[model samples]
Target chain A: MIEVEALTKRYGSTLAVDDLSFTVRPGLVTGFLGPNGAGKSTTMRMVVGLDHPTSGTATINGRPYAASPAPLREVGALIDAKDVHGGRSARNHLRAVARSNGLPDSRVDTVLGLTGLDAVAGRRIKGFSLGMGQRLGIATALLGDPGVVMFDEPVNGLDPEGILWIRNLLRGLAAEGRTVLVSSHLMSEMAQTADHLIVIGRGRLLADLSMTDFLEQNGRTHVQVKSPRQDDLAPLLRAAGGTVEPDHDVLAVHGLTCEQVGDIAAAHGLALHQLFEQRASLEAAFMDMTRDSVEYGSGSLPPPPDSALPPPPDSPDRPGATEVAP
Target chain B: MTLPASPTANAASPFALDGPVHHPTTLDVVRSEWLKLRTVRSTFWTLAVTVVVMVGFSVLVCAAQVATWDQLTAEEQQANPINGVSSALAGLSLAQLAVVVLGVMVISSEYSTGGIRSTFTAVPRRARVVVGKAVVLGLSTLVVGLVASFVAFFVGQLILATKHFDVALGDPDVLRAVLGSGLYLAACSLFGLGIGLIVRNTGGGVTISVAALFVLPPLTALIPGTVGDQIQKFITSNAGQSVAATGSAPDRLGPWVGYLVFTVWWLVLIGVGTWLVRRRDV
Candidate 1:
C-alpha cells in the first residue's frame, strides 16, 4: 500500500500540491484522475520521496521511503518516461538503476525481455523513440519487481497497441494484489480500466468512489416522451405521479419509467412517436462534479479514445456532479 | 481540500520486505557508477585525449627544452633543468576541460533528462548514490590519469636522453611530479563533479566549473599583492600545479599547502552538493 498524508509542496509562492492526501490500496487498479495543473505528478513525486513535502509526508507500506532499505524492490515507479541518460544504452541504464538496489545482472535482462526491449537493449537511449523510451521506463520500474507500482501519464504518447499493452500490464499487476496507482487526464480510459476512481481537481479530492457507486450515486433517471398530443398526455402523466418539463415537441418526464410513460400515453389515447429513458453520461457527470475544480478548463474537443463509454455529466460546483443518490 | 495520506501513516508496523537491508549498498552503487562511466562514449574519448595529450605534449616540450639548453647559463639550466616539466604539463590545462565536462555531465544530465527522479527513486538515500559515484569516478579517473602522466614522463625523459638532460624516476621529485600530477587532475575533475551536483544543470554546472578553475585564478591574480596571495593560494587547479612541481616558481605556492588549498575548494563545493542532493527535489 502507498500512503500519502497531508502532503504539500511549495515552489516560492505557488503551492504545487496543497495538503494532498490519497491512498493506493493493494489488489486493484486505482486511476488517479485530474485535469492539468492538478498536482498529480507533484503528488506522485512526494510519494516516491523525490520531492520532499513541505508540510506532511508520504510512504510506502509502512515506513518512510528514505527509511526503506530496498526501495527499488518495494516501490517501483515510472515518474518520467525520458528519465534515462541519453548517452547510455538501454541495457546500461537499467543496469545502473538495478545495481543501485543491489539486484543481480540477470534481473536487468529479465526486465528487458519482459518489456520486449531485448532487441534494442544495447542501443543508446538517445536513439529511442518516445514509445521505446516509455518501454525502458517501464522496464526500470519492474526491475526489482516491487509490490507497488506507480506510473505518471503512462499512455501520454502511446499508439493504440502500446496503450492496450499497458492497460493489460497494469491490470495484471493489480491482479497479483499489488498496489497500482496510474494517473491520466482521460475519463474514458478510467471508465474502462479503473475499479476504483480517485478523482481530484485543484489539488483537492472531488470523489473517492467505486465505478459502480459513482454511477449509482449520480443516477438521474428520467424519461422522454414525444408525441403530437403531449399537451393532453402532460396532465395525464403528472396526475399519474410524474414531473413534466414540456418542450416544443417532447415532454421531459421524470419520476416515471419509460414503460409507464408509454402506458400512460396509450391509456390516455395519445399517440406517442418516441418514448425513452435517459440518464446523464459518465463524462458529463464527471464534468459536473469537477466544474469548479478544473485548473485548465479548455473548450477544445477531447481526442476520442478507444473506449465506447460516453462522457460523464458536467461536474457541478458542489460535488459528484449533482449526485442524486437513488 | 482532501489531502493525500500523511507521511505518518503505517509508521509502526515493520514489513518483512522492508528494513536497512533493502536500501542500496556501497558496493552496488560503485558498480552502478562504473556502468554509468563506461556507457558514455564521451568518457572514453575524454580519457583517450587526456592520455594522448599528456604523452605527446610531454615529448614535444621536453625536446624543445633540450634544444634550447645551449643558450642558457649553467645556473639557469640547473635550477629549471626539467624545462618547467610541471609547466610542460600545460596539456593538463586543456585536459582538465574534458574532466570538468565529464564530471558535470554525470550529475546534470540526470536533471536535463529528468532521470534524476528515476535514480533517486531507486536509491532513496540520495547522498550515498552521489558519494558512491564520486568515489568510483575519482578512483578510476585518478588511476587512468596516473598511467597517462607516468607514460608521458618516461617518454619525455627518453627524448631528453640525447641532450643529456634525462631525468630518472629516482630523482627527488620526478616520480612525485608524475604521480601527483595525475592525482591533481583527478581531484580537479572531482571538484567539477561536486559543482555539478549542486548546480544540477548542464549549462550552470559547466559554467561554474570553467569559471572556478579557468577564469577565477587569472582574475584573482590581478587582485594586487597579499590579498591575492591569500585567495589564489586555494584555487584548485592553480594550487594543484604548484603541489606537483618539483621546484617552485618565484610566485608559485608551496606543494603541501597547495594540496590543502585544492582540498578546501572541493570540500566546500562537495559539501554544498551533498546537502542539496539530500534535501532538495531531484
Candidate 2:
C-alpha cells in the first residue's frame, strides 16, 4: 500500500502538487487520472523519493520510501520510459538496477524475458523503438519483484500490442496482491483496467472513488425511447418528470429509469419500437467531473454549468480536506 | 512466443530477497557503479583514446627530438631540455580532454538519456550515487593515467636513449613528476565529473570543464601585471601543472601544494553538486 498524506510540492512560485492525500491499496489496479501538468508525475516522483515533498509525506507499505532498506525490492517505479542510458543494452541496464538493490544477475534475464525484450536484450537502447523503450522500463520496474509498483503514463507511446501487453501486465501484477498504481489521461483506458481511481486536476483531488461508484455518480444512466409516435410520447415522458431530448424519431430521457419511461409510453398507448438504457460512459463521466479542474482546458467551449457538479464530499481540495473513499 | 513466468511466483529464483530488505552497502553501490561505467562504449573509447594520446605524444616527441639531435646547437639543445617522463606525458595536455569527456559523460549522459531517474530510484540515497560515481570514475581514471604515464615514460626514455640524454625512473624528481602527472590526470577527470554533476547537461558540462582547464588559464594571462601572475598560479591548469613539472621554480608553488589546490577544486565542485542533487527534483 502507498499512503500519501498532505503531499505538497511547489516549484518556485508554481504549486506542482497541492495538499494531495490518498491511499493506493493492494489487490486492485488503482488508476491515477489527471490531465497534463496535473501533478501526477510529480506525485509519483515524490512517492518514490525522486522529488522531495514540500510539506507532506508519502510512504510505501508503512515507512517513507527512502527509509525502506531495499528501495527497489520494496517499491518499483517507472517514472519515465525513456529514463535509461541509451548507450547501454537492455540487459546491462536491468543488471545495474538489480545489482544496486542487492538483486542477483539472473533476475535481469528473467525480467528481460518477461518484458519480451530477451530477443533484443543485447542491442543498445538507443536503437530501440519507443514501444521497446517502454518495455525496457517495465522490465526494470519488475526486475526486483517489489510489492508496490507505480507507472507514470505507461502507455503514452505504444502500439496496440504493446498497450494490450501493458494492460495485462498491470492486471497480472495486481492479481498477485501487489499494489499497482498506473497513471493515465485517458479514462477509456482506465475504465477497462482500473478497479479504483484517484483523480486530480489543477493539482487538487477531484475524485477518489471506485470505478463503479464514479460511473454511477457521474455517468448518468438514461433511457432512449424510439417510437412510431414520438411526438405523442415526448410530452408524456416529460410530464412524467423525465427530461427529454428529441433526436429525429427517438427521445433521450434522463432522470428516470427505462421501466418508468416504458410505463409512461404504454399508458399513452404509444407504439414503442425500442427502449434501451444508455449507460453513461466513464470517459464522459470523467470529463464532466474534471472539466472545471483542468488547468489547460481549451477555452473554445463555455464553462460547464456549476450546478451540474457538486464537490465530492471526500475530495481533498486543500490540507485537512475530507477523506472520502468509495 | 514464450511468456516468462511471473516474477513473484518464481520460487526457483536464486535471488529471492524475502524476509527483510537490507540497504545496499557502499561497496554494493560502488560495484554497481563499476558496472555502469564499464558497460558503456563512451567510457571505454574515451579512456582508450586518452591513453593513446598520452603515450602516443610521448613517442612522437621523443622520435622528433632524437632525429634532430645532430642538427641542434649545443645551447639550443640544452635550453630545450626533455625530461624523460615529462616528454612522454606531454600528450596529456591534449589527452586530458578525453578524461574530461569521460568525467562529464559519466553524470551528464544520465540526465540526457533520462537514466538519472532510474538511478535515483534504485539508490534513493542521492549522495551515495554521486559518491559511487566519483569513486568509480576517479579510481578508473587514476589507474589508466598511471599505466599510460608509465608506458609513455618508458617509450620516450627509449627514444631519448638513442640520443644519449635518457633519464631513468629512479633519476632525481623523475618518479614524483611521472607519478604526479597520473594523479593530475585523475584529478582532471574528477574535476570534469564534478562539473558534469553540477550542469547535468552534456554540452554545458563539457564546455565549462574545458574552459576551466584550458580556456581560463590563457584568459587569465591577458589580465595585466602581477595580478595576472598571481591569478595564473591558482588557475586550475597552472596549479595542476606544478605537480607535473620535474623541478620547482622560485615563483611557483610546491608540487604537492599544487595537487592539493587542484584536488580541493574538484572536491568543492562535487560537494556542491551533490548537495544540489539531493535537494533538486529529478
Candidate 3:
C-alpha cells in the first residue's frame, strides 16, 4: 500500500501540490484524475522521492521511499516515458536500472519480454516510437517486479490495440493483488479501468469514491419527453414530483424516470410522441465537478440552441448519443 | 500486446517476492554507472580521440625536432636542448580538451535528455549517484590516460632515437613525467565533470571548463608583475601541467604541489554540485 500524509510541494510562490493525502490500497486500480496542472505529476514525483515534499510525507509499504532497503523491489513507477537516455539501447537501459537495485540480468530480459519489447530490445531508444517508448517505460517499471506500480498517462500515444492491451494489463496487475495507481485525463479510459478514483483539481482534492458512486453522484440523468399535449403533461409531471424544464418540443424532466413520466402521461390520457432517459457520460460528470477548478478554464462558449442536449457519448462502444425510446 | 504473466503473480502477498532485500551499496552504484558510461557511443568516440591526439601529436612533434636537429649549431643546440619528458607529453595540451569534453558530457547529457529523473528515481540517495559517476569516470579516464601517456612516451622516444637524443624510462624524472601526464589527464576529466555538474548544460559546462583551463591561464599573464606571476602559477592548466614538467623553474610550483592545487579546484566544484543535486528537484 502507498500512503501520502498531508503531502505538499511548493515551487517558489506557487503551490504545486497542496496538503494532499490519499491511500492507495492493494488489489485495486486507483485512478488519479486531474485537469492539466493539477499536481498529479508532482504528487507522483514526491511519492517516488524525485521531488522533496515541502511539508509532509509519502511512504510506500509504511516507510519513506528513500528509507526502503530495496526501493525498486517495493515500488515501481513509470513517472515519464521519455525519461530514459535516448542514446542507450533499450536492453542496456534496463540493465543499468536493474543493477542499481542489485537485480539479476535475467529480470531485465523478463520485463523486456513481458512488455513485448524483446524484439526491439537491441535497438536504441531514440529510434523507438512514442508508443514503443511508453512500452519500454512500462518494461522498466515492471523490471523489479514490485508490489506497487504507478503509471503516469500510460496510454498517451498508443495505438488502439496498444490501448486495449494496457487496459487489460492494468486490470491484470490489480487482479494479482498489487497496488496500481494510474493517472490520466482520459475519463472514458478511467471509467473502464479504474476500480476507485481520487479526483483532484487545481492542487486540491475534489472527490474520492468508487467508480459506481462517482457516476451515480456526479453524473446527472434525466428523462427526455416529447408530446402533442405537452402543456398538459408539463404540470401533471411537476405535480407528480418531477422537475420539468420545457425545451423547444421536448420536456427535459429531472427527478423522474422514463416509467414514471410514461405512467403519468398514460393516466391523464395525454399523447406522448417520444420519451427516453439520458444518462450523462463520465466525461460530462467530470466536467461538472471540475468546472470551477480548471486551471485554464476556456472562456464560456454560448450554450447550444437546446439547453437539454445530451452530453456526447462516452466511447464509441456506448452509443450514448443515440436517443432510445423505452 | 499479450503481456507475459507478472513475476509476482503467484506470491502470497505483494511485498513477498523471492530474494533477500539487498540495499544497494556504493559498489553496485559504481557498476551501474560503469554500464551507463560504456554503453554510450560518445564515450567510446571521445576516449578514442583523446588517445589518438595524445599519441599523434607526440610523434609529429618528436619527428619535427629530429628533422631540424642538423640545422642547429652545437652552442644553439646546447642552449635549447630537447627535453625528453616535455617532448613525449606535448600532446597533452591538445588531448586534455577531448577528455574535458567527455567529462562534461558524462553528467550534462543526463540533464539535456531528461535521463536524470530515471537515475535519481533508482537511487534516491542522490549523492551516491554523483559519487558513482565520479568514481567510474575517474577510474576509466585514469586507465586510458596511463595507456595513452605510455604509448606516446615510447613512440616519441623511438622517433627521437634516430638523432641519438632519446631518453630512457629509468632516466631521472623521465618516469615521473610520463606518469604525471596520465595523472594530469585524469584530473582534467574530473575538473570537466565538476563543471558539468554545477552548470548542468553541455554547452555551458564545456564553455566554462575551456575558459578555466585555457583562457584564464593566458589572461592572468597580463596582470603585470609578481602578482601576475603568482596568479599564472596557480591557474588551472598552468598548475595542472606542472606535474608533466621534467625540470621545475624557480617561479613555478613543485609538480606535486601544483597537481594538488588542481585537485582542490575539482573537489570544491564537485562538493557544491553534490549539495545542490541532493536538494534540487529532478
Question: Which residue pairs does candidate 2 place in steric collision?
Answer: A83-B114
Candidate 1 at residue A220, lDDT?
73
Candidate 1 CAPRI level: acceptable
lDDT of 2 at B157: 90
Better of 2 and 3 by DockQ: 3
Q: What DockQ does every candidate get?
A: 0.42, 0.41, 0.43
lDDT (tens digit, per residue) of candidate 1 on A1-326: 98888887776776667777778898899999877666787788888887788898888887787887677777779987877678888998998998888887888888888888999998988899989988898989888777788998898788899999999988888776678999887777777788888888777778888877876776577788899887788899999998999866878888899988888777778898998887755666676667676664555555342223333333422221122211
Q: Model 3 scores what on Cα lDDT?
A: 0.85
lDDT of 2 at B148: 87
Comparing candidate 1 with candidate 3, which one achieves the higher lDDT?
Answer: 3
- Of all native A–B interface contacts, model 1 reproduces a fraction of 0.65
Quantify all predictions' global Cα lDDT against the true fold. 0.77, 0.83, 0.85
Which candidate wins on TM-score? Answer: 3
The sequence of per-residue lDDT tens digits that candidate 2 reaches over residues A136-245 is 98888887787788998899789988899899989888877778999988788898899999999878898899988976786677888899988888888788888999
Please provide TM-scores, in order, for all candidate models, with all chains considered together: 0.87, 0.89, 0.92
By TM-score, highest first, what's the ranking?
3, 2, 1
Q: B161-193 in candidate 1: lDDT tens per residue?
A: 887667777878777787778888788778888
**Tens-digit lDDT track of model 3 for B131-189:** 99999999898999999999999999999999888999898888888888999999999
